[model samples]
Target: MSATATTTVTATDSPRKGRSGARPLHLPGGISLRVERRALAVGVLLTAAALALAVVLIGTGDFPIAPWDVVQTLLGNGTPANDFIVNDLRLPRVLVALLVGAALGMAGGVFQSVSRNPLGSPDLLGFGYGSAVGALVVIILFKGGATEVAVGALAGGLLAGVAVYLLAYKQGIQGYRLVLVGIGASAILIAVIQYLITKAQMIEATRAMVWLTGSLAGRDWAQVWPLLAVCAVLFPLVLGQGRALRMMEMGDDAAHAVGVRVERTRMLLMLAAILLTTAASAAAGPISFVALAAPQLARRLTRSPGGNLLTGALMGSVLLMVSDLASQRAFGADQLPVGVVTGLVGGIYLLWLLVTERRAGRI
Candidate 1:
């Protein structure tokens, strides 16, 4: 063989027989786990901030416990009034906010990672609308209560997700196609929801109206239990599939080359995301923007290339808790829906993302 050809053979073969049985030198998917370390820090900071905001708001309630009193109550040493304000009312609300936010964040992170698009979220993809459609159907048709409505929402979100997947699969499930199809599906569901709202009595509409806005008000342990069920089931399932999800960002063929079941993995992740979103929506009526905004904010905070699931969940919880606080305090007579507050902020952020993408020539 020619010297150059011999050299090329040696160079190619050498790495295939390294000290530890000849391994690939490259990081998986041209991405490094090193970046995710900072994600942990960002998640912690965001969680602390969220807790602080919740505490501050709890202390400033109608009863007005001091910060110290709030701490004492949290630690089981405060006055009865302080305990009542923090543990009974505000604590449950905060816990719900955190749970809902975490679910949205996790769902959003999964969707964004799967789609490889920052804009792909449960809210934007119509999953939230699916939940609404389901809940509305139960509320209107069956006169179901909150629990029943929640189940309907879950079923609706899953059905919508499946429909989107089937529709988007015709062309090999391109990211943009999936997003577009999901958006269209969501519009149809929204129309159905509107129709249901119109047909229902005003009293019935009152419940739907409150649910539509995604408020955490009146969410006691009952709502919290269902959310817990969802988290308990879905959280670990998603985490277990993280490696497969990471593999998928490199496109189907590449993921498959690494022994990842690309289609199955994507489908499972999508389903999990749907379940989480549905559970959250059922609990709090499609609380807006946490699913859309948290992951993006997490990426920014961690200075990572894209979303981190853990960090996104923490950021989401914080965002929701802070929004809830604002809603409770900012309006004197009428407490605004937490979802509305998140939607306003998230909408602006979405616009900003669009502008940034355009500026970066990604459009």
Candidate 2:
């Protein structure tokens, strides 16, 4: 090749490379193409619909503010009574639901995506139980409230998740093996929860009942702070690994060939997922089904073969908001545990999933 031609090519390529580095650009629809963008749009629309449902449900309580009043109060232009009811009373509850639901949705997405199992979720795979066990230990044994409970829950969840990993590591981590181990671990943890309940004094047990069953009633800023912390840290950490995770999901050999550190990436993602789930549980005891359902729901709505983390988070927020609203208004003033409402819905969905899988011989 002529020196002049080579020099010209190098000069042209250098500016293009420099611009790519400087901008680090992403398209409006993200890295993937049209299908992903369309699915993302659908998930977002569904989430918005769910949020609207939550507003109606929340406003229909005993002191009853209309939807317009709720909007007015939200915009800082409503009557004092309406403002207090909507903002002071219901707003905090809604915030907690959104936080917890978003955390669970992302946690579920992380677990299922990292483990490569659609059935793997924090609640289903024992991470929730681990957090619950930890929080219960703190509340029951040490008489600690929010702060200690949060720490204990995070510790317990990580420990339980590690235990499941070790047990399933007999040959090496495979998706199905990890899930089966998690199921067994969850069963044992449930027994432990029952034992703790039986051993506690009645008053403590009654208070713990709220934790065990998962209720958003009387939730104040204390619970909100921990969730905020988790969201702040965990989301960034997980998001930073988005490119790495996308590669790892394609299997270890393929990922390794692409200059990825498979084991380390998996471990980090697993730990992040555990921490997110633990923090949510600590904030509000295993709120149930949202963790198990949000990712699948996101995937189905988006028609994506795998979970979309952002979409899943939105779906989760909507699920919890709607469910908590239902629990609060379905009966009366006091409100049922949000867990009960989610459990009923989640359980039915789970059963249907099993039936479909069995019929298709996918199980």
Candidate 3:
């Protein structure tokens, strides 16, 4: 009943195990471990690629520094000018982009696994719309600063998620029901956001519009620190329940039969992923498609089942970093927000996804 239900064997035959070459390595104290070699390899490669992209991003800004210089600056061994450019200026923005992407990727994986659907993402869960509502409310009505807007978005996203959880709880929540309720809530939240925009002054409306695009611009240590702190806590918390989550993906009855405590694990994953998604949205204004696409991409790349949190996290970071690079250098002198780049790519990806789903008769 595991995600890798590739083969079945009866008691008269041999012990049941996946065809994934997942042999148990007996440790001292008779502890055996099952590691999916391909998946782990994929995760390692992704981490390397993400780091390489991060270095490229840090080094290729307006005041360009060589990759070596960027590394040296990070190590406190570069000249003051290079140090300022790499450490003081570009590093925070790059970190924010990487962290936000990783958070979104992991959260998306959790949601998708929980719902047993590829489209199960923060936006589909209404968290992104809810966060947008909070941010727009601050931008339009309160005339708030960047920090205030972020705080508002976080609060709004959490509230929206709570509401969806509550509404979907008919004795207990089902994955499809949760997604449906969240979609309904998202529609309402989208309307609220539009209304807020209509009521704003021209300047406020413009500000709101830009934020809605989900950029990583003007980011500094201030944004990076808190997001890092949140990811630090929530990432492990989510990963710790990965086994239970995979079991739940099989089905509630099967999971319960295996002592999986399906409901509690589901609740834990949902809450953790909510915090992760909201934190990422608040940090970078809901950069489109990372949550929706990262997990699926990682799954495909690894050719593995279940959440694949670590691989997704790395893929998300790399995807966001590449988009940020495209925004900064691909266009002419005029700078583009990272969100615009992501949106364009995400749109195409979503179309492809829809077509695939339709062909598969899963839509």
Candidate topping lDDT? 3
Candidate of highest TM-score: 3
C-alpha lDDT values of all predictions: 0.77, 0.75, 0.83
lDDT of 1 by residue, 199-267 (tens): 999888988888898888877788877788889898777766765666577678977897987888888
Pairs in clash, predicted candidate 1: 18-22
List ranges where model 3 is wrong by over 4 Å. 1-19, 23-32
TM-score of each: 0.87, 0.85, 0.93
Candidate 2 at residue 311, lDDT?
72
Candidate 2, residues 182-230: lDDT per residue as tens digits? Answer: 9999999999988998999887788778788987877777778778888
Better of 2 and 3 by lDDT: 3
Please write out the lDDT profile of model 3 over residues 293-326, one tens digit for every residue: 9989988876667887877888889899999999
Error of 3 at 5 (Å): 17
RMSD of each: 8.5, 8.4, 4.0
